[model samples]
Each structure stands twice: as structure tokens, then as C-alpha cells.
Target chain A: MSTLIGVDWGTSSLRAARLDAAGEVLEERSLPRGILTVPAGGFPAVFDEACGDWMREPGALALLCGMAGSRQGWVEAPYAGCPAGFADVAAQLTWIEPGRIALVPGLTCHEHGVPDVMRGEETQVFGALELLGLQSALLVLPGTHSKWVRVIDGGIDRFATFMTGECYGLLRQHSILARMMPAGDGELDAAAFVQGVHHARRSGTLLHAAFSARTLALFERLAPAAVPSYLSGLVIGEELRVQDLRGTLSVAVIGAQALTCRYELALATLGVTVTRVGSQATWRGLRAIASTLQGTS
Target chain B: MSTLIGVDWGTSSLRAARLDAAGEVLEERSLPRGILTVPAGGFPAVFDEACGDWMREPGALALLCGMAGSRQGWVEAPYAGCPAGFADVAAQLTWIEPGRIALVPGLTCHEHGVPDVMRGEETQVFGALELLGLQSALLVLPGTHSKWVRVIDGGIDRFATFMTGECYGLLRQHSILARMMPAGDGELDAAAFVQGVHHARRSGTLLHAAFSARTLALFERLAPAAVPSYLSGLVIGEELRVQDLRGTLSVAVIGAQALTCRYELALATLGVTVTRVGSQATWRGLRAIASTLQGTS
Candidate 1:
């Protein structure tokens, strides 16, 4: 029986799962895989340390996703465009150090005159689709750069990225709002956020409305720390307004529990129904790509 | 001849003038005065140092304006309502250490359900009025918090404060826009700012539109340093749109030349005529207040 190794090499961490032919996990390990950690020549050493134990499982085909397939990764794989099926990504796979490793190609798409690119999450999107047998659906991946991706016929047709997470980080760390907010306070101010979203949808100029947070502080001495969360609600609310997700069917969210919950809350505030996919969705995506490649090869 | 000392204590700096009974300056000095520098008791020493030489002129009545009259200042002076004629502010003056020192009350206005307040620059507004011999006009005080104040019938009536300068500082120092923007490279991009303003006015969601800066960077790879300037343009542009300043009799900008120029550019983009008031405007304003008080007394 053949064995398989699935790796998700993201900006911050590398997670690997060793599985049997039937996709039953035999072992798993996580290691630091951020851009800073694996400078230029350090990738090989870190990758070896992360997966050295499973090396004895001879002929184990390693499938990698995320930034590991970028120009800066272990192998550079070109992006395949949407309506791109599993076969498209499998065709672009590049081997690193001969037969031991293969890197999954990311997906790219242009929609509504905007270009959307993804590195690792595309695999997860693909996996979610495969797992649910979804042919067409709207996928929302919430994180530092939250993406709203449209999938048609099992291919990523288009997506838009919002700097929601990065904006939160900056406001929490650098803005006056940081002083009033406490760490890990992720609770939703449903009323405030919903109000903000409604206002944003109506007006669409978040730059001006954002000052209201400070104005509330100056005028009423509202806590500055709560401003970030308030801002998150406002932006997310505005996104909901602009996207008009109220009538969309089958919205799938792929991210961590906490982040997904926030997205779910924001969408719920706008009366949108959504399904959540966990971290393992990414691994499953990589697995699906591996299986597709194995079938064709 | 009797003598008077007029002081302007703002967020960053303090300026004190030793003037004769006629309000002619015999000498003047300035020093830093923000809460950051004079935390509590430190105010007394800093104030004394800034005016020690002028204090040698005996029996001069010291009058102060700006944040020095705020709750945290040497003494808190309550706000007088608009049309805050000279008499209103003069009546609310607070004495500190008896007749030797007095703090000028700032102007406060409740108009159209919005409460507005002003500290140091109300003096300048009054000064510009006296200098121009105009009864009603718009006064733009440009700074970290740029104030667009309305003067009607020889009284300061209403105003709105835009955190323009503070926003510029925050974006330049903290946001991704900082990567593209350079310090003191504030060449106004009238087109971009106007576009931003229009976007803001239409959308009314400043936070949502702010990401446009990052989006522009990602899609166009536009100079990162130019982002701050673009943001500035957008904010000012929005202000012009919302305020709808057309065919006003006159526009007087009160602040440093550099800041005034930015406002001028924004106004020019909106096709509004503007004239800049000098640093002496604040002094003249203080003198006007003193004269009005003397006349009433």
C-alpha cells in the first residue's frame, strides 16, 4: 500500500500530515514556515526537519500547497486560470528534488476587470468543493486579507480581497483605537457593525465614516480599544452591502473558527446564510489534487 | 502705560507675547506645550520658562487661549456659545492665581444638532474678522485636525473639524500607504483627492474606500510613497463635496503656509477661491478679544 504526505506551507507555519493510501492519517507535525524563517537556503533544512521521520515510508509522494509553490517556495508552479478544473492544476505540478515531492499550482482568475490570485487557499477551495460535491457556489475565505471568491463548475471564476485582517492589525497596533481595545476581544457589536454596514452600503465612502469612531471618542469619550472592532464591523458591513449577499445560495467560509465566526456574524447581521470549512479543508484540497494527478498519470 | 501678555497654548507649542496697553508686542517667545510635554505639574514650569523674561515687566495681566484652557490646562475655562461674540468669551474667563493670570474661554456652538468647540484658533478667527473687516465668511483652520469654521454677524457660529493632519500622520507613519509615501513630500494630487472625495461622498463609508489606496498599490504598483498624498487628496476632496462651498464671499485659511497650501489645493480642485491668513491672525484675534473686553468693561 502506498503512503502520502500532504503539506500546507503558509506564510507563518508549515503543517504536514502523513496518510495511508486510504487517506487515514498515520502521523502529523507542524513547523515554522513563514517567509522570514526560511530565508533563501534554509527551506531544505526546515522541510527535512518537518518531514524527516516520514522519509522511511519509501515512494511516499509529497503534495505541497500554499506559498511552498510560489516563486519563493521549494518549487515554482505557474498559476492556472479558472474554469480551471483539478486537471489544470495537476498539469502544472512541479517536482522538487525528483520523485519525492510535488508542489500544487495556485489558481488565478480575472473577473469584473479585477485579477484575483491565491497561493495555498485555492487547494482548500477545491477540497471544499470536492467534499461537498458542489459544482457552483460562493466561497468566503476570511483572514488578514479576506477574500470573497466565486466558483462556477468547480473552478474559481473570480474573487475580491479585502484588507480586513490587516486593517484590524494596523488599527489595533498603531491607531488611537488600540488604547481602548483589549487583546483577544473578538466579540461582535452586532448593532454597531450592522449599522455601519448599512450606512456603508448606502454611501460607500468608508474613509469619511471611519472618523466617526474617533468622533465618538472625542464627543463621548468612548473607549479607543473598541474602535478597531467597530471599524471591522463597519468595513465588513459595507462589504456585505456592496456584495448584496442576502440572496446568494450556499456561501462557504474557509478559515479558522474564530475568524470564520466573525465573518459569519457580519454576514448574519446582513441576513446571509453560510457554511464553514475548517483548516483541514486545505489538506483535503491538496489531497484531491494529488488523487486527480495520480488518476491521470 | 499698562501692559498685557497674550498666550496661545496649542497641542504642540506655546507662544506668549508681551504687549503694551495698545496690544503692540514689546517681545515674544514660544516653546512646546502639548500634554505630552507638560503632564500635570510640568505645565507651571514650562509656562514660566516660556514667559520668564516677559514676566519681568511687572503687573501685566496675562491672558491665555488654546488647550491651556482645556480641562488639563493651568485652569479649565468653560466654553461660550456661538454666535460666540467677543463678550460671551470675555464673560466666561477663568482666573488662575487671581488677577495675575487669566484663561480665555473657547467658543462653543450647538447648531443643527451638532456641538462644535474651539480653543486657541477662535482668537485667530476673530483676528481675521477684524483684519478683513468682514462680518460673515468661512474660516478654514488647517492642521492635524483641520477646522472649517463659520462666522456670521461678527460672532463665531458653527464649525466642523476634520482629522486631516492627524490622519495624514497616522497613514504616513503606520498604514501600508506609508510604504509609498515620503515625509514632507506633500504635493497635492488634486485629481486623485477629488476622486476620493467623490467616492467618499457617494459611499459615505470612509473605511471601505480607504482600502482603495492598498488596492491601487497592488493592482497598479503605484509608488507606495505617493499613497499618503493620494489619501490626503481623497479626504480633502470629500470635504469639498460634502461642504458644497461655491460662491462664498471669501475663504480664509488660518495656519502655517505648508498646511494652508494643501487646503488651497483641495479648495482649488473644487473651484473655490481662498486667501491665507498669517501667523499674526491669532494674535490679532486675541487683541480683538481683549479690545472687545476693554470696551465692554
Candidate 2:
């Protein structure tokens, strides 16, 4: 029985998991070494440092996902076009050490002549599906770039990326709205956040809605501490506002607890139920892909 | 026949015009000394430096507009509630040297319990109306914060502020999309820009439409030099999208030529006509208010 060392290496951080043959995680480790921080040609060294011991084990197969497979990573794994299933993705893995180490080719889909690509979230989507036991579902992986994905018949149908998280960070830190917010992170003011969500619907566009963060504070209506929460709600709410959530019963929220919680609240406000999934989806997803590749080999 | 020193002082730069009794420009001067750059109690010095010679003249009353009236500027100029015209704005002016130096009280309007205020744009809105000699029209002042104003019966009825410019600067300079764009300002790619404008409508929200700027580049569909123009179109297009341009035949675009030209192209794409107005609207606006104040005195 071969052990699988699955890694979810994104732009800012890396997480690795060692799973047994049954796809159960036996141990896991997280590091600050996201692809961006890794020095040029240092990916192999960082990978070794992350799970060198696990790699030393005979019959150990490794699967890496996320920005690690991007153009800037160790090796560029070309994106697999959408409507891709576990088998489809497994077949497209770019091998680093043939028959031992491989990288997952992220998924891309086109709409109206524009291409939308996801490096790591595709793996998590499949994992979320398997964990939730759903053949088709709408999954939202909210992060720096929030992905609204659709799964049908155990494959990623199509997805859209909203720069919600990144925009929020820019507005909170670099934009004029930052001047109205407190110096550091503040407690999420639930009421203010809800107000922002609702305001987004009324404000009509994020470009206009974002300014409310400043005006609300300027008028003494929203406290400076609550500005961050309000701004978060505005961006999140804008992200949700564009999607046609009508008749959709529930959405699977994937990411860390803090981020997922915010999405959950925002979704709940719009009368949509949410199923929470942890980062374990990444490991589970890589495990599924590895298992499929193993069977094919 | 008294002369008026009309100042358009904003966050980044200050422009002052010494106008004769006929409102014709006698002398014009612009400095890097904006409200933000003016040190504590230094506005007077900077103001003097900008137009001290003009201010030294007997009966040279001064009318200042823009951020100079904000809480952070020379003195906090409380916003005058809207439906403000030349007379209304003149009445609310905060006097610095009683009847000699006054700051134009910018306009504020409320909708759905949210307040939208403009410090500098209100002046431009009035000036745009006066410049075009129209009692009622839809005017757009595009800049760091774009304003869509509806003029009715020669008064500033109500307006909405879109943080389009500021958001564009933040995204172009700080966001991930910046990585794909060339380091310096790129020439406007007319075709790519038009595509971006049209894409904004299809993408449904700026949050989503912005990601296309990256994906299009990643796929090599959009040139690196064209990214900035495309982004400019996306934000400007989104600003135009939310407005009910149904019956608006023509929109008076008041701003710098570079910005107004972009707005003109975008508005033209949407089947609306645009009349370009210059920054002179600020001076004209203040002159009108000063003239109104002089008549009353």
C-alpha cells in the first residue's frame, strides 16, 4: 500500500498532509512557505523541507496543487479545461519525479471570451463534493480570490472568480476608506456588517457601495472600529449580489473558519443555507486525485 | 467691481484663479500644496503663496472649494444639504476672514439611510451646469471619486458618488492584476477598452469583471500595455451601468481631459452623448457663489 503526501501550496502559505491508503489523514503540517515566498529554483528544497521525511518513505507518492503548479512555481502545470472530473485532472498532472512526485493541473473555464482559472480551489471543490456526498452542488471558496463554482455529476462545470478578498484588503489598507477604519483588525460588528450587506444591494455596485464605508463613519453612523466589518460586508455582499442565488437551497462554504463564517453569515442573510467545509478538503481532494492516478498506473 | 480669487483645493493639488468682476480669468496658478500637504495652520501660508498677491489686493474676496473645507482642511466646512444652488451654497459658506475668505459648503444627500457627500465635486457640478448653461441635466464629474449628479430647476438636486478612480488606482498599483500589467502607464488601447466596457455589462459586477483583466492577460488575449486602459473601462463602465441612463440623452462630463475623454468614450459606447467640460468649472462655480455673496452684501 502506497502512502500519499498531499500538499496545498498557495500564494501565501503551504499545507501538507500525509494520508493512509484509506485516504485518512495520518498527519499534517502547515508552513509559511507559499509559492510567492519560495526563492527561484527553491521549490524542490522547500518541498523537501516540508515533507522530506514523508518523501523518504518507499512507495510514497506526492501530489502538489495550487500556485505551486503556476508559471512562477517549481514547474508550470497547464490548466485542464472545465467539466473536468477527478480522472480528467489526474491524467493531466505534470510529473516532477515521474511515477513519484506530480503536480495537479488547475482548472480553467471560459465565458464570453474571457478565461477564468483556479489553481488550488479545483482540488478543494472535488474534495468538498466527496465529503458532502453530493453529485452536484454550488461551492464558494472565499479567499483572496473567491470562486463561485458549480459541480454537476461529480465534475466542475464552471466557476467565476470575484476579487472580493483582495479588493477588501486594498480598500481597508491602501484606499481612502482605510483612513476611517481602526489601525488594526476590529471585532466584526454584526449589525454594521449586516447593514453593509443590505447596503450593497441598494448601492447597486461595489464601486459605489465601498464609499459608504467612509461616509457612514464620517457621519458618526458607523463607528471606526466597525468600518472594517462594514467594508467586508460590502465586498462580500457585492460578490453575492451578482450571483443568481434564487431557488438555490444551500452553498458549500470552503476555507478557514473565520472566512467561511463570514460567507456563511452573508449567505444566510440572503436566505441561503450553508454547509461548512474545512481546509481538509485540500488533502482529501489531492488524495482522491492520487488514488485515481494510482489506479490508472 | 471686486476681483475674486477662486481656489479649487482638493486632496492632491490646489488650483487658484484670480477672476475679474466679469468672471474672466485674470491670472491662474496651480500648486502641489493641496489640503493634505498643507501643514497645521499652514493653509494660510500655502493659500497666500498660491494667490497672496491677488489676496493682497483690496476687495479681492476669495471663495475656496473642495477638500479645503473638509474637517481635515483649513476649517471644517459642514456639508450643506442638497437641493443646493449658487445661492444655497453661498449661504452656507464658512467664513475664514469674515466676508473676505469663504469655503464653499459642499452638498450632501441621503438615500435609504445612507449619506453621500462631496467636498469638491459639488462645486464642479454647479459649474458644469453654468458652463453648459442648462438648468437641468445629468452631469458626471469623473476623478478620484466620480460623481453622478442630477440637476433640476438649476439646483443640485441629488447625486451619487462612485469611487471608480480611486479603486482603479488601487487595483492597477496594488492588486494582483498589477503583476500582469506593465510597470508604467500604458497607452489607451481603444479596442481592449471597449471590450472591457462591454464585459462589465456581461460580467454583472465590477468585482467579477476586474478578474478578466488578469485572465485575459494570462491567456495573451489582452496586451500588457492595454491592461490599464481595459481596467479603466471596466471601472468606468460599471459606474455607467448602475445609472438609469434610459432617457439621459447627453451627460456633461466635467474633469481633466484625460479622464473626461475616457468617460466620453464609455458613455458613447452606451449610446449616450457626452459634452466635455474642463476643470474651469471649479473656478466658475466659485465665482458664481462669490458673485451671489457680493450681491447680498
Question: TM-score per candidate, in order?
Answer: 0.78, 0.97
Question: Who wins the lDDT comparison?
Answer: 2
User: What's the residue-level lDDT of B205 in candidate 2?
Assistant: 91
- Tens digits of per-residue lDDT for model 1, B162-280: 65565556656776557655576666655665555555454433444555665566556446556666777656665555574766745898888877777776676556778888877
Candidate 2 per-residue lDDT over residues A1-297, each given as its tens digit: 689999989899998999987668899999999999999989999999999999999888999999999989999999999989878997899999988899999999999978999998999988888899999999999988999998889889999999999999999899998887779876778888888888998778998888888888888988888889988889999999988887899999998898988888888898899999998888888888887775454
- Using TM-score as the measure, the top candidate is 2
Worst 10 residues of 1 chain B by lDDT: B200-209
**Model 2, runs deviating above 4 Å:** none
> Candidate 2 docking: what grade?
high
Candidate 1 chain A TM-score vs. reference chain A = 0.89
Instruction: State residue A35's C-alpha deviation in candidate 2, in Å.
Output: 1.8
List model 2 lDDT by residue over B103-155, tens digit each.
88888999887899998888887777888899999999888888999989988
lDDT values, one for every candidate = 0.69, 0.88
Query: In candidate 2 chain A, what residue range of length 10 has the lowest lDDT sum?
Result: A288-297
TM-score for chain A of every candidate model?
0.89, 0.97
